[model samples]
Target: MTTYPGMPAAPKKSVLPTIAIACLVIGVLVTGFFVYRIVVTVPGTPQPIEAGMVHLEKEGLTIYASVPVLTPACEAQDASGNDVPLKGPTGSETITINDDTWYVVARSTQPVPAGDYSISCTDDETSATYAAGPKSSVVAFVLSILGAVFSFLIFVGLGATLLTVGAVRKRRGNRPTNTFPGPPGAPSNYSQQPPTTPQQSNTFPAPPPYNPGPNPDRPQDR
Candidate 1:
């Protein structure tokens, strides 16, 4: 149960892979949302009217009883059933669809004939304008899908990374490791001393007393 001082702790299984997986999921979701928003329309929303009838009053003036639909996702057509590009003086005019609403558009290139002009209205649910036009709703839709995909990918990546790191740590933990000698073991390569034999001291016999010359001198004196 003891942990080594320098050993790294096992990584928890709750990180990296989770983040990556989240990102991937978020990305896909955002993409799907974008697709959906581009398709459906809500009633009573400000939609464009095409081929709208215009009542001409003067040489240079044409008054459209109902303004042409110029918003993205809706298509505008002329009275002749031709696609009408929301342009000219009335192109950007804001006209309500109510019975009392009226829009004034003017043109200088051609003299207005004093007559009644009729235009038609049609809704194109698959118009490219919704996908690429400045007012297209696809941008928001796409972002939602992307966000979801990214989140999912992030989760996956974080989870995988955490799992891998934890597994490696566990493997190392179970392996036998070289241990440094501490209090329980002797130091490596310790040497022991061998016993030796005791040495004996030799004693020579005492030399005879040195009394020859001294005895002769004493005798002469006596």
Candidate 2:
């Protein structure tokens, strides 16, 4: 095989594409998991709240409950059948039962006013009413969606980076290397040089002196 003297070797194959593909798959899985958590209720034995009226002995009562995707509308009522709005504190807490996770929905700082009262929650989507207790909130659902979108975008960016690197490597691998040209009139494997010629001498040999015979007019002159 003919080889160029100063040619660089072809680039090695790149693993970036493989790594990018893995990242994409992982990102998809993570996004799907977060989306599922947002929509589905935590799995466990259901805890049913009492059907009758509940009395709040203290001003600040923390409510905990499990709910689906949408946040529920909740209220408290006094014995006089007057509706009271419940206040929710910021942040939430998680509860685990048999390895299943649940979220605290609301907490109130104001006093309930010692009296016969009832708490109820209505689903925002279905408008179904239930005894007020604990349920998932809008915050959890929004957070889950945000997390999923962020994770997916990050992974996609990584994959794009890897793909770009792989393409660059492939292009380099296929590129032609610089080559040195062979000498003129030389064999394929040999280097050629200019031919050398001998120099001529400047001096020449002297000719012998000229000799003449006796002329006819001077015959007999001996």
Candidate 3:
């Protein structure tokens, strides 16, 4: 029987292949999740938002505001406290204020011009901050559940792989019953019995010196 010396062969692996596989799996999962969100959770279509119009009244430099104390309200006023005719269109539009755009309510009037003009809307100004509907909430819950499942699968896979490798090593008679050297109470530097065969020294062999010219005693005029 022949025996091989040196470390055991490690499982074959390639950096590019592993990375590509991981990226592909991640891309597929992410694309599926996003598609699900867009189709099911997100609102299918936006309905028209109604707006109640209030004619502006001139009073001093600022308009004395009077809005209903009930449903969503939007205040429209100008610098000179004059009523500015607005289309009051519903559904979504951008209004500029001081060169900065502010996305007001779809049901509200457009923003006022520069100067002392300012319009306030009940709708949130931040586009990212949306009033999530029930469908969106349910979608979030589903995503959370999926995330948990994926995490569990990864952890379980890793643990099972490690356990299987350990079992195989044990069957091959290489498992360590004790990884530490000697008894627990023994000092770390405690010497042990030397190997039966003496170890070969690692010192380098001596080299012969170089003679540049002929020996002085041998030369001398030939």
- How well is each residue in 1-222 modelled by candidate 3, as lDDT tens digits? 343543344433434444445655665575566555445543222211222322222211111112212223445445566654333323343333255332322221333333433444464433231110011133464575576466546644554555566556546664333333556798644667876987899999898897667666776735
| C-alpha lDDT of residue 196 in model 3 | 100
What ranking of all candidate models by TM-score puts the best one first? 2, 1, 3
Work out how many backbone clashes candidate 2 has.
4
User: What TM-score would every model get versus the actual structure?
Assistant: 0.29, 0.43, 0.21
The CA lDDT of each predicted structure is 0.42, 0.61, 0.40
Summarize candidate 2's per-residue lDDT along 1-222 as a digit string, tens digits: 465665655456678989999999998899999989766433223233355476544333345455422445666676789866565545555555687555555545454555456666555565322333323345566688888899899998898888998988788778664355566764554545689898999988998888877777886855
- Clash number for each model: 67, 4, 0
Off by over 4 Å in 3: 1-136, 174-222
Alpha-carbon RMSD of each model: 15.7, 12.6, 23.5
Model 1: per-residue Cα lDDT at residue 211: 68
Displacement of the residue 183 alpha carbon in candidate 3, Å = 35
In candidate 1 the C-alpha lDDT for residue 30 amounts to: 58
* Model 2 error, position 22 (Å): 1.1
